[model samples]
Target: MTRWTQAAVLARMRQEIEASAPDPGDRLPTERALAAAIGCSRQTLRAALARLEAEGEIWRRHGQGTFRGRAPLGHPVRETVRLQAATPEQLMQARLLIEPAIAAEAARRASRSDAQYLLRLVEDGRVATSRGGAEEADARFHRGVAEVAANPILIGLLDHLADARRRAAWQREWDRTYRRIGVGEFVGLHSDQHQSVVTGIAEGNADVAEQAMRAHLLTIATAMRRGSDPADPGL
Candidate 1:
């Protein structure tokens, strides 16, 4: 019997692709068909496909078959269903990995207009008339920072994160955490962190901007993750 492992399947799959001369954005065969052609089980073929997707040799749409190359123009860049179900901790980890770098980039690219916009956003978030208003302003502030970075890829990532926040599960956890924190704590803690981040951006200080953004995200993660897992250490 042949040991048709994931790596072996991946090799066969690549040979097929090379033979076919797959064009960018061309649709690949379905997993079952591909597996049959490659003489492998569906599970092994799936593992190989995941590697290809991560390497940008292919991309997947939720309901569509995998396609060659990066995501097509105007199509969803990521599988939105995953983000739609991500827990607060998962989102926090993603934000920690992504947003701090964008904050630093925004600092490096800061213009007079960018500084003014960030400052205005900070003030709006600070003085929001109600809890809902404050949350909206906070969302805008983060989105504005990604915009100031001036990178379409970074902006797209933040846009996906925003969509995640609108999902029912994410929103429920967010609302619970916000209620626990209360408006006074938001004004005292989170608002101050926002001011610090914008100040770093306005000053074009990349180090300060990154640090402030990381700290801000940490504070939020701590609040949302609290009691969800008693052993999580709330980091």
Candidate 2:
């Protein structure tokens, strides 16, 4: 029997992911099955999966199985697949309009438990070591705030916005920008802003929540602008 090196195992697993050709939101098979199919131990398979996730080749939800590609910021990629693609500015503008209001409403309506949940999301963002992990927390934080507002209409709308982030063109642009801006710095800045938003919501100050969220979005806009000139036809 051949002793499979971890690097070799990882290469094989990646080939499988490509061969399977799962859509962005499609979940891969269980570890046991994948390991069996690849003739590797579960521990080896998990390591390969972790590397794939860190490289933004795949994502994992807390309860959901591992998904095939980078998770979108706002909505499931499947939801946005049929919708018309949005420009980066359009996506940012939509968030500016919707998210601040959601934060304000959450401040007014959130119970103590709800505030705790939001804080937990903040902590998740702070501790995230990979771009995909930070992004997952970011998406869940926004969705969590919307959920706290108890507005289904806004929730559905936000999902569309989230899904837009997963567009191949959009992700490529974001990736290019982040490569220029430094992913670690970007994640750190985002984590700080996340804490502010949570604090504003937990304090039940609608104005504070609105301002915090607006400021946070503006900071992100600034980073995006710094990374890519919106007027560039190539973008």
Q: Whose lDDT is greatest here?
A: 1
Q: Report clash pairs, candidate 1.
A: none
Where does model 2 exceed 4 Å of error? Answer: 1-83, 230-235
What is the lDDT for 212 in model 2? 94
Clash counts for the predictions, in order: 0, 3
lDDT per residue as tens, model 2, 1-235: 3568988988888888776644464557778788988998888788888899999998766544666777655445444433323467778898999899999999999999999998888888878887888788889999999999999998988887876777654576678677665657546777788778878888999999999999999987776776677564331
> Candidate 1: deviation at residue 41, Å?
24
User: Residue 139, candidate 1: how far off, in angstroms?
Assistant: 0.6
Over the stretch 1-235, how does candidate 1's per-residue lDDT look in tens digits? Answer: 3568667778898877665425554556788778778887787788898998898887777665666666644324555535533566788899999999999999999998999998898888778777888888888989999999999999999988877676555666777776676776665677899889988999999999999999999989888877355565533
Please give the lDDT score at residue 96 for candidate 1. Answer: 98
lDDT of each: 0.79, 0.78
Model 1 lDDT on a 0 to 1 scale: 0.79
Error of 2 at 83 (Å): 4.1
Candidate 2, 35: how far from true, in Å?
50
